[model samples]
Target: MWAVASLLPARRMLASAPRGDGRPVMLLPGLVNSDRSLFLMRRYLRRLGYDAVGWGLGRNLGARAIGGEGERLLARVARLHEESGQTVTLVGVSLGGIMARFVAHRLPEAVREVITISSPYAGDPRATRVWRMFERLTGERIDAEGVVARRVEIARPLPVPATAIWSRSDGLVNGLICRDPEEDGCRAIEVRSGHLGVQIRPAVLRTVADILAVPGQGPLGTFRP
Candidate 1:
């Protein structure tokens, strides 16, 4: 429904959105999804004058999809940083956002900032409606010791600028856990959107562009629009 609703207004939204400074923005897809899911978003970003691309690693099946300990993901970011001669901005949806945070933690120097769309990185994995599916696809128990520890680690304050776009209307995950309230560096933006819809919603796209346009040294505060 969100994808369909986004169609009519997408063109108008893209036309009025804030332009980018040609910084490379990498879009990461959600669990059980591939770069294909974010085609519209990439197109919109490109239209907004940003060089946006997908996380070329096919599907996002957790560590398995990106290689052990995200070595492959790190390499991808490093390559983009080297090629662009600028820190890359990561925009991730759902599980992809979690992975983006992990990558940012691993390669802070190469990452400009991270933007997560409805990514539940702040709380229990079971709080999400798709935990069971996540386990089946990744073959990792959410309750396992390693998984729990990793969650704690990722939930901590990120070293660089961070933004979380989440919705209370999200049906797939607990919205409260999507952003870290204690992280002063992380800007939490609230929107009225379903879990999947938030990715393509026009308002969300505009918010992303606005955040991206802010200078690196500028302050990031909560956005309620």
Candidate 2:
């Protein structure tokens, strides 16, 4: 539904939106999804003049997918930082967003900021519709001691700038848990979208581009168009 709605409108939105500074932007896909899931978004960001790329680690299967302790993902960020000579911006969707937060927390210096779409890092994992699937795929129980500790770590305030784009109507996860209300460093943007729709929604794409265009601004800073 959102993919169809975003087709023409997304093009128009990008046409008039502000361009980027050629900084490297990495798009992370959700669980059970690969870079193919974010192809359109990556193309859109590229058209907006940013050096956008995928996580390059294939599908997101939690820590096991990125190497235990997220070493592989961290190495990817470091490599992008070295090659681009600038910090990288991470845009993650669903489970991808959780991984993005983990990476940002582990290596703040290499990251410019993080933008999450319908990611439920701040809430209980069991609140999501996919928790069982997550456990099956990752071989880690949601209620495990390590998993709970990791969640707390990721939910902590990030050292770098952060933004969370979520939808209350998201059917897969409880939307309220997507953003931490007490985290002043993390900006929250509410949009009308379902769990999957948030990724392709025209308004969400525009918001992301706008955020990327301006740096070191408050959450309510004017969007460039």
Candidate 3:
């Protein structure tokens, strides 16, 4: 039922969502998900005048996306920034949002802003429904010192503007923890949505479009929600 309901709203936003200034955007998918999961969002953003592209890293593999010496994920962001010759905005879902923050922190000059949907970067992994599964798939124990340190790093504010969109009804990650810790460089939007639908719901899509449409202020000092 949720899946069927999402289509109408998503379609509605596709037609009515505000257009942006053709800025380059990189859409990052959640953990264990692939670029295929973001195809619809990318298509919609493209139609709305933004140059949206995928991370092209296939299925997300947690830390590897942003860790190790030659990180393939960072390479992808760099390539996009170079190709577009403009600062890239990152729109990340779930774990992808955590990666986006890391990217913005590492390459602040190349990143313009970040928008996260249903991400638990500031939350405890144990509070998530799929925390165990994530640990299993990524082969990184949540209790490890290194893992905890990295999570702490991801929770910090980025040099650029940031926006976090979450819902109280989220079933996967505890919704309360899926918020921005600091409002100085970030703003939080509360929506009545499930974890899965937050990224595709019409209202959320419209909000994202509007956020991206803001001029020089980006969502930081401009967006109210």
Error of 3 at 44 (Å): 0.6
Full-model lDDT for every candidate: 0.86, 0.85, 0.80
Model 3 lDDT-worst window of ten: 215-224
- Estimated TM-score for each candidate: 0.94, 0.94, 0.90
Report backbone clashes per prediction.
Answer: 0, 0, 0
Candidate 2 overall Cα lDDT vs. reference? 0.85
Candidate 2 per-residue lDDT, tens place, 97-186, comes to: 998999899999999999988999998888889999999998889888888888999999888889888778889999888888788778
RMSD of each: 1.7, 2.3, 2.6
Candidate 1, 58-87: lDDT as tens digits = 889987888856888899999999999999
Local error of candidate 2 at residue 176 (angstroms): 0.7
What would the per-residue lDDT of candidate 3 be over residues 1-225, giving only the tens digit for each residue? 675476784675458766678899999899888888888778878999999998887788786654553277778888889988999999999988878888888888889999888889887888899889898878889888888887887788778988888877788998777776565778787777788746666666777887798722544322222
Error of 1 at 103 (Å): 0.8
